[model samples]
Target chain A: MSNEITTRMGDGERVLFSAEEIREDIRVGTAQAAERAGIPALSAEEQEKLFDIIADPSRIVSVQPGEEVIVSDDGCSMSFYGGQDGGGVGAPLSRMQAVLTYERACGADTTSLGHSDYSFKPVKPIINFEANDYYNTSMVTTAPFFYGAQPNLGLYFQPDGPCPNAAELMPMGKIDAARQAQEEAAGHLTRDLVFVGSRLADVGLEGLNLDTSGSAGDADFLAALNAVARLKEKVPDLPILMGASGEFIIGMHGEVEYDGQRLAGLYPQDQVKVIETAGADIAGVAINTTTTESLPWNLSRSVTFMKAASEASNIPVHANVGMGVCGIPMMEQPPIDSVTRVSKALVQIGKADGL
Target chain B: MNKEIFESAADAILRGDPEKAAEVARKGLGEGIDPLTLISDGFVPGINKVGDMFECGQLFLPELVKAANAMQRATDIVNAAIPEGEGQTRGRIIIGTVEGDVHDIGKTIVVSLMKANGFEVMDLGRDVSTDRFVEAAEQFNADIIGTSALLTTTMEGQRRLEYKLKETGLKKRFKTMVGGAPITQRWAKRIGADAFAENASEAVKQAKALLET
Candidate 1:
């Protein structure tokens, strides 16, 4: 037919590949599969022309009713249909060994550095931050600390989940009832933790400002201590690695300078307060995402959180920027980055507070 | 002397006052100033100052975004007056926050910057998919496919899209670009991508270069 450049290169029309949208695409693709059965969209006579489109699209690029497309890069290594078996959405979930599984298996063709194997790292820094929100959410994580080691980190979700693992507000009424049925689901953490209702009777602190110099600080510290109390009651000598369950608390979803954070020498002090009150043995810290800061602030805050936690807690905090940075199952893009390193920041904070 | 205009413009834009910034730009433009000079010396300087403040514990995200918006508003005025066909189409780019990740602010900046630069943008929104990217690329004939991930879980989705593109033979058809929180240029190269941009500004430049190359 016509050999010309069909691509108009309109307003940034480049496709952004993602996994979430892929799942839906397969559904639509499978519908196309059912319609076409086995008729090839690229005809025997048009094979050369089809390859021409691969190199340049001014040729015959068509969708013959329900026929699927066979795409390839470089016009050489062509894989049939939307995927290997002409399966679109159902390809991943097919009974005959998933196409994704095959792609993940690094055969002779596996040349990528990220991995074809859907790798799941078992060991990575597991950080935690205390989120002020009543609901459990995944605050964005970033890498200022462990800056060079972005891929080496993994994120985990062990929020200060409700006793029934329910968020603070939801009707956990079913929690107690379901607990007996699923013994494994029964939670063991201490409950009804207390936080300061107001700033000190002396300090200028007032009304829920999160600075450590106030009543709200005292309340948060007391609450952390409560967790320690329960842990101590269970095991008196066990070294406790107190976790911060949040993102950042600087601004409203924290984004400004006044809302930004500084590394305080004494870190994860909320947990420290709990351990001190219970007279429990403190072990390590889990530097985590901030409550207010999402992924945008992840890298910077990850370092800051680690610094403060280590300064105050006097413990090795596992900084987790990789978990939040990758934006994996979400953006499908790699994580955002920062300039500092977690361990280095911790050491610096050590000097700041004469630690 | 030019720095004075830059500072005032930057100040106005940072305060969410694009109108004042635009007026400042017009004054400079009327005085036989180079377009690029006025852009970098006046408008861009202000935006960059705000961006720097945002980057180093100085400014905040909302404020930075707002400032960027204001700067964009002023720049649009300047750009419109530059006469038709004279301005270059920076590049057409598609950007998105990948699947499962809800954070869209960072990508929003990239989109804004690209759009402001005269690039035609087909934003697929957040929580995009690998196949959807291919679909959009094929449908739009996109020159550069961009993906942004804000979480570790979500970044893996980018790699998946890459492999899918390869297996489906779609990888070579267009330039694959990657960025976001966890994504580095090294990772982009390792994942077999065309290029990796560190920030929104860099992303626009890189995407333009990618498609042109």
Candidate 2:
């Protein structure tokens, strides 16, 4: 398809883009659109750099099998693997192996990767204004460039929130804004095999209060589902990962309206239907509990949630490992064994059903 | 003494039905039911059950928050009925998610659980600084100071709070409690924290235990 496209924006306004304009201007229109909508815009230099790498396939570099690639700033390098799937192509296992080997080589415990008492000053906020194609392309390109030696580096994108110029599209209502957002996402999907679409909740939940009304919540849910649909339409092979608290997913699956009602369920099996209906490739439940403090509960709950998600889609399920539980605040560093056990459990689950 | 009515109140809290819990609490108080009796026999038991369910993964944070809301509503009605000078509290605690950490779901769960268990919690919210922890503890006359950090990078804030307590010579004046996903009992001990709670129920136990010590 030619780059010339007449896209209907969120506000019922048709944004006419000529193939020549996009080729010449790169992402100046996206930035200008964001600025007009009162959202932040990236610096000219950053935008140029970002577009340069994405627009030109020649700028993208690949590592050959067994070639040494740098993994960390501390001069860490590892032999490259050819596979791209986690167990099959990606380097989750091999990355761990490299780390293990590196530590042993340095006369440190295989577990001692971080410093016992590392000191750092307060971090300044890094303003990120390019929240559209530039953002997606940057992540899609960067994550792999550093860790290209590892297996399965899929372009994981989460455009659950509206792009920077979303409000400009909002004149047409939430549905239109959502549709426009999806259209923008489609632009990003043209170049990369974005393997995973995550943070779908970001579309609805962003900039909204936690006590969002049922109508608003419903709109968000629809928007998220639509975002997934849009991404999938663009890249049929892309896997969509839906992120939310297990309770939230349970509520959605139960068709619980956003009336601020506390949704209680003994199990998450019922929530899987929503995932299937939304066309999610994998279910990602937030296991926001401390690994060591609540090991048994954490493991059991993760397994149960994953099993429910798995049963729903007959697909692999993943957990977003968050720190703390009801009583816990956060841990400095999780125990090596805790990390190992959880990884092993996830791997086992993946091995059994390819989750 | 209308035991069935009191039981209904407890059921409302357990079911996370705040409106029902409040309605029953108001009706019971109008009928001259003792405030302490309503709390002890009605709300406390109900919330304890919620705590148990939460620990076992039977109830998640949303359910726990609902139950806490119910308990709070009932507790407010019951507490308002008692004589002004006769108020009782388990302990006054100041809790917050530490600096550079914005995770609050876990902290919010702990806050609700602590409230359900009768602790007067002053939640300073997320991304709180060390001086703020010390300042809040001092201002609130807190018996316990709790800090939560979700990231490994921000976990140092907990240690910083511990250090500030020492530098200010308030270490012995207030008990320090540390928790989070990565915080183990060892880290708590290493940082000179008085207690390390694994979950909400354990937090209650540890808070009480720390005060006693």
**Leading candidate by DockQ:** 2
Misplaced by over 4 Å in model 2 are A1-226, A234-237, A241-273, A284-312, A318-351, B14-34, B50-70, B80-86, B208-213
Every model's DockQ: 0.03, 0.05
State model 1's lDDT: 0.40
Predicted structure with the largest lDDT when compared to the true one = 2
lDDT of 2 at A296: 29
Docking class of 2: incorrect
lDDT of each: 0.40, 0.49
* Clash count list over all predictions: 80, 20
What are the runs in model 1 whose C-alpha is more than 4 Å off? Answer: A1-355, B100-122, B137-143, B150-156, B163-174, B180-182, B198-205, B208-213
For model 2, how does the per-residue alpha-carbon lDDT over A1-355 read when each residue is reduced to its tens digit?
4454432211112244454443334344334323322333334553443233222323122222543222121113222121311112233434345434444454321121111111000000111211232233323232211111100001111222224222122211233443345345333332221222222112211110000111111223333444455556654654444434433322111123222322334223433445445565554444444434233224433443444444555544444443332111233333433443344433333121321
Write one digit per residue (lDDT tens) for candidate 1, span A1-355: 2333222111111232233332233233223222222212222233232223222322222333443211111100111112311112323342212222333332211110111111111111111111221012111211100000001101111122222221110111232332232121111211221111111101211111111111111122333344445534544543333333232221111211111222112234333443344543332233332212222122223333333444455433333222222111112222212112222222332111211
| TM-score, prediction 1 | 0.44
Docking class of 1: incorrect
What are the per-residue Cα lDDT tens digits for candidate 1 across B68-149?
Answer: 5566667776676676887534465666777876555457556655654445677887778877887887888777789998
TM-score of each: 0.44, 0.54
